[model samples]
Target chain A: MKAFDYARATDLSDAIGASGCLIAGGTNLLDLMKLEVETPSALVDITRIGLNEIVPEGDGLRIGALVTNAACAADPAVRRGWPLLSRAILAGASPQLRNKATTAGNLCQRTRCSYFMDNRSACNKRQPGSGCAAIGGINRNHAILGTSDACIATYPGDMAVALAALGAQVEIEGPGGTRHIPVADFHRLPGEDPSRDNVLEVGEVITAVLLPAPVEARQIYRKVRDRASYAFALVSVAAVLRMQDGAIAQAKLAFGGVAHKPWIDPRVDSLLVGETPSKALFDKAADLLLEGAEGQGGNDFKIPLARRTLAAVLAEATAE
Target chain B: MAQSPAARIAVNGVTYEFDGDVRRSLLDFLRRDLGLTGTKKGCDHGQCGACTVMVNGRRINSCLSLAVMHDGDEVTTIEGLGAADNLSALQKAFVSHDGFQCGYCTPGQICSAAAMMEEIREGWPSFASEDVAGRVHLDDEEIRERMSGNLCRCGAYANILTAIKEVMESGAKP
Candidate 1:
């Protein structure tokens, strides 16, 4: 859309220190730029930075930032070890999009809120101090769990939800140094400034995502959307469970399309940790997770929808 | 501002070097500069797959990718798939099945299906695949799910499905 300088970076240090917006895959950023929603003076292409490897680290796997969504999902080790990640990725976007979209790009993608994308609408996420139009207008797809007076935009990604359930960590490289941020704490709630999606500071770049050792659990990623395919989730659930002696030994749950970030609550997992599989127990866990979830006018159905989806996923996962 | 570097990309085995505007999309470059207008521009966003093209052997929305980002990459557009005299197998199937009405989305559909067949051969699973780790079976559901990116506004999906099924059943390399 706007004329800007572009250059490819082959070295990690060059990419990290470049004074330009990082562009990988360019699925989301370029779309926003076309709409004049995102205007950068220059772009530093990181596709050639050699961050595209998916290798084994310790007992787990380290996925490079430049790995495409399709490559990551189709990897043999990923499909066998972390099926939830594979399933979650395949659930989102179309085949063509997954082919070009990168791992870190998906994590850093902006919300699909119409107001945020439409420069005409009053969106605090787009322009701070402006009013949020989705708060009271066409909010059926807005966030219900992490709503603020300023914004209610959903994170709009399925892979992050699975990663949150897997307890993955995001590796960051910046001018200061290299550090890791847990996926759960990476995305921020739209407290007052919704402009910043994640916790990355200025000039910081996501290098890779470190997945902890795969757990011995039955994993499933179930997404409910307006259509069967090529649509964003209305409400999605990622569940990881381990059964021992007919009792739940471990339970991890993360919800998508319901919050500003992948919604995860430890209380729900604690409730189902040692409990035997039952509809009643699953309902309680769902209730605890949906507690205090206030929905906007059009999205009130998501509350019950999320509850039923969560219960169904838990039931299906625990079913013999 | 500093001048951007030149981008060299190969389309249909022909390499071309250009020093164009950094904001130029791959779709625009193919249509306007190269005069390869077989690729259509529907939404100009990633939502519509009208601009679908293969970059480095993978289908991607050309409208969403900057041409400058494709330096040293090989691209295959509808024009490169096959000429009118020598149509690709998928293209021939489309003609026999009447898989299009306006034919605006046909190029994207064929290009996408061509690459999709490769994905199936590689056992890359789709959302419709029951077993993500198991061998892929090309059922009607898998074809529909994989082709959901290309939108045929003329409601010709039934014919499109039939055309793709014919190619798949014939075991022809699309």
Candidate 2:
């Protein structure tokens, strides 16, 4: 809780124009600040910049970055159009945390890796080249896919997983200008540097998240946690499927708690297209989805758990 | 005094102007600056709902938010809900149902339940809600799912559930 100069941003320019870190809800930022994991010299409050609106764009919805998780989940348009987003967000945090967490902050959230949070531990994500303790230490909740020797942390947010499946686009404003990034490509894997979670450049302020037109598909977000609520996902699935005349018309799949980012593969959907929903088909697709999955010592259950979760989510989405 | 930045906030209808450290959380602001100790701080984090408070008609973990961030926002703590003489319906229900064995987490639980009830009234859906657009009925599963954030180590969940149900049935709002 070291003293940091605080300022309020009045507009989009003022927000991104400043040189300090932008804070909206302060749910995740403050936690890291208290843990000393993030110690910015200055903080720019962006909540007052009037970014809380949820508006309609071209055949889609544009959610302002400041909109709280609770508001996003309860929004009538979101519930009707992108029900998977609502369910995914609700699956992550409690009611109180949801009330304070914002859509943009959720997407920009850091991993819940215990080593990264502990300053004493040698975490490459927290301090590059220090070494990753989770690789040798307890790694039960570590990533199973897209992991490198540098870090094994998992992207813990549930909303991003659904957004990745729905093909959502992020609207960002920075010193360069405004740009849109696909949700699938927003987060990065641990190749050489695990410190960087997303492709957000420095001083880039997220403006809104644009979700495409309603997919007339059965959307489902199934999360398996150790506890019934208020727990991180052991392995989760966000799936959207459209069935036409006993055949699959369109399919979108994203897996969470299994990789450095929300695991989304177009081939899973392509493999299922024009095919009827069945256990065998789902099992085959599940195997294909976990093809390159490699579990650490303690997280071996995630392989089978992720497979079952994918199959179960597919079955639930296609259930008559 | 460190002469830190000052923020303005209205608590339970009374506006208070106080100087707060930039790093001080809303929970500390209410407890230390304004002396509103009724809102207990358990974990000093968002995990435990013991620091729950109502901010602009919504329940939030006060410990997770900085005091300077909530400037001009209306906050309501447990003390605002009821008094010793005039107990709110939920307070009365808690008393009758024995909603608590140890009263440390009572304030937070009550505040959370109040805001949760309001959320349900406004058609807000919980994770357990079968239909998002359908009417929110106060059922056992719904109540449990909605109140799952507030933990009670005393194992008074049954009584807490009963108290919340009674208050809901009695149509309570604060």
Candidate 3:
């Protein structure tokens, strides 16, 4: 990795106030640095800035972006209150990774651009206007939903997808001040400007993510993929359904491995809200969500695979 | 030599100043800097579980992470799991169950198992669990799901799980 100034911040104020690129665990940052995808002149270390605390905020739990993946999983509130988040984190990489991975860094990690990782090809994500090679090249794992002609990269983290489903709020500190942004709006889709990855502005440091108290619903996070473990999702679903006497009260659905952001399809959720938990409900939601999915190649199967996963999760969720 | 980012990282109760390269992984710093080499590096791409360790008691892929990020953070590596003279119940159980082939992924396996036990103890549910309202149970399927992150090329999951079950059934750490 190329040399970069490493400075430690003292507090949330100092950490967020300090200049240069912000690094928490350096898991994602260093990986990109090694690949030369990120070349920050200086890195402001924010781990010891005392942002690792999981505290009670206004309406929910305020999870410091620095909180380790393991801590989040073991947290009482998270374990019981937000099983979707817990299951999502556990379904992610590994124990060693959860230790070093932080909530904020995981949320903001660069796209896992294979061509960008190669550093020799035209990746609009790595280099703006270089053109996307994956558009014509191997796009097997590329997105099938919310894609543009510019880019088709998918957001890789599992927990973020769950957060989006739970209506979590990401709190960040920028030149303005600390503000709460809905997790659903945090990441952006590949529109005309594929250069900007997330909604985070320049010189902004994510302080915490707030997940509201659990709704009385069944949350089932199902990620379908090629392998059983340690791989990105082929098409993952983070769903929560509130059932009253075997009838759906409300349902929340968000997707990963299909779009730029965790694809939160409330339209699908709306379709399933009044209906009973059945294959019919899942199929309707799948049909509604995939209507927007413009698959180019082999990714066409994800449309039905996503439907199957929804049915499976709804079946499992309604079972108990 | 790069300025070692070693300064008072409170690891597992004791504070140690580990001399580590900025580019060196948290796995390397734990194994080499502190002379606690129990954490092994399998693939270094965060694919393998050989470098598994607990940061504030959460399991993570250490190879993918840098050491500098762990400043003042608590780390519990495999060496802290009972030491050479002593052994954690899990460690003893692993020996009893013979959960090793080449013994390369054992350290990570134990660390991940310990962390997984803690997670299970905390009532965190996995994907395999059907019921979430009741006490989240860690059955064969749940164990397979929790321990799936730690892959043993030797495919000693059966024995590895037996060792974990032995420790769990013993009613230890209540």
Candidate 4:
């Protein structure tokens, strides 16, 4: 890794001004620095600021961005109230990884595109307008739902999918002021501007993530990946359903590893309301969500794979 | 090479203050700076668990963390567990069951195993967690699931599990 100045900041704004990038736990940033994927002029260590609290605020949780994935997953409040998120975090890399990885850093981590991995390869996210190689290149794991001509790389983590499904919100301090962005709106789709991933403007530091009050629903995070553990999902679904007398009262379905943002289908979810949740209803909702999935030749398999994942998760939501 | 960055690191009750680069990893600080060479580094990427260590009780990938970030924090490396004279139960069990070959990944594997036992004790669970909110039982499946992070390319998982099982049963300092 290239040489850089490091100092622990006393406050959030001070950290933003002292360094080019904020070092939460140094899990993702240090790896990239070693690989030369990320080379900041200076690193502001934010571990000392005590942003690691996971407390109940009003009816919801105010999860400090610095909370380790392990702590957040292990917290009693999270285990019972938000099992979807807990399971999603657990289904991630491994026990060791969850310790060093912070909630804010997990959301802020860059894409995992193979082309992006190789700096020599043309990746729009790595070098804006350099040209997207994953579009025509080997894209078995590339996105099919949210993409433009610029980028096709998918969001790699599973925790964010559950967060989006649970209606989480991110609190950030930027040049403008402290703003709370809805988790769904925080991450942008690859519409016209593919370079901009999160809506945070320049020099914005995330303070904490506020999870909205847990829904009175049966929630499950169903992830389908090649490996048994420590692997990214192929297509994962975070489903939360409230069934009233064999009929759906309300539902929230969001997908991961298939789109730029959480692939939510509230319309298809609406169909589940006031209806019995059978394989047929789940299949219909799965079909509706897959309508926007335009696959590259190599990733054409994901079109059906994603639908089945969603269907399976929806079915799981209906069961005891 | 750049100038070393300065931070206070307390590992296994030993305190250290050194100037190390911001980019230098916590693994490097432990092995190179403090000379606690028991910890190992396998894959520099986040894939392998060879560089595992404890920061304030929770186990994390040391390769992924910068040394200077952990100021005023208690860290525990493999060397902290036990030594030749007074070996931890897990260490002795490893010797009894022959849990290692090549042995490069032993330090990391041992450290990871130690922390996972604590995680289970606290009722923290995994994907296969039977009751999401209920008490988590640490069965074979639970052990395998929790210890999945540490990789022994030599395929000594069975012996490793045996060693851990002995330590859990014996209730020693491993």
TM-score of chain A of each: 0.99, 0.98, 0.96, 0.96
Give residue B43's error in model 4 in angstroms.
1.1
Winner on lDDT (1 vs 4): 1
- Per-candidate Cα lDDT values, in order, are 0.92, 0.89, 0.79, 0.83
Query: What is the C-alpha lDDT profile of model 2 across A172-206, one tens digit per residue?
Result: 99888899999999999988999899999887888
lDDT of 3 by residue, B1-174 (tens): 112245557766888775555667777777777777788878777777888888777787788777776766788888777876788888888888999888999988888888888878777665566644357866888888778778899988999989888888887841
* TM-scores, each model vs. reference: 0.98, 0.98, 0.87, 0.96
Alpha-carbon interface RMSD of model 3? Answer: 4.4
Can you write out model 4's per-residue Cα lDDT over B1-174, one digit (the tens) per residue?
112346788999988885656666788888888888888878977678898898888888888887777777899988888888988877888889989998888888888888888887788888778766778866787788888888999999899988998888777766
- Clashes by residue pair, model 2: none
In Å, residue B39's CA in model 2 sits off its true spot by 0.4
Pairwise DockQ winner, candidates 1 and 4: 1
**Could you tell me the interface RMSD of model 1?**
2.4
True contacts kept of 2: 0.61
Best by DockQ: 1
Question: Model 2 reaches what TM-score against the true structure?
Answer: 0.98
The window of 10 residues in a row where model 1 chain A has the poorest summed lDDT is A8-17
Poorly placed runs, candidate 4 (over 4 Å): A16-19, B1-5
State candidate 4's DockQ: 0.55
**Clash-forming residue pairs, model 1:** none
The recovered share of true contacts, given per candidate in order, is 0.73, 0.61, 0.41, 0.68
Model 3, native contacts kept: 0.41
Model 2 sits at a Cα RMSD from the real structure of: 1.9
Show model 2 residue runs off by greater than 4 Å. B1-5
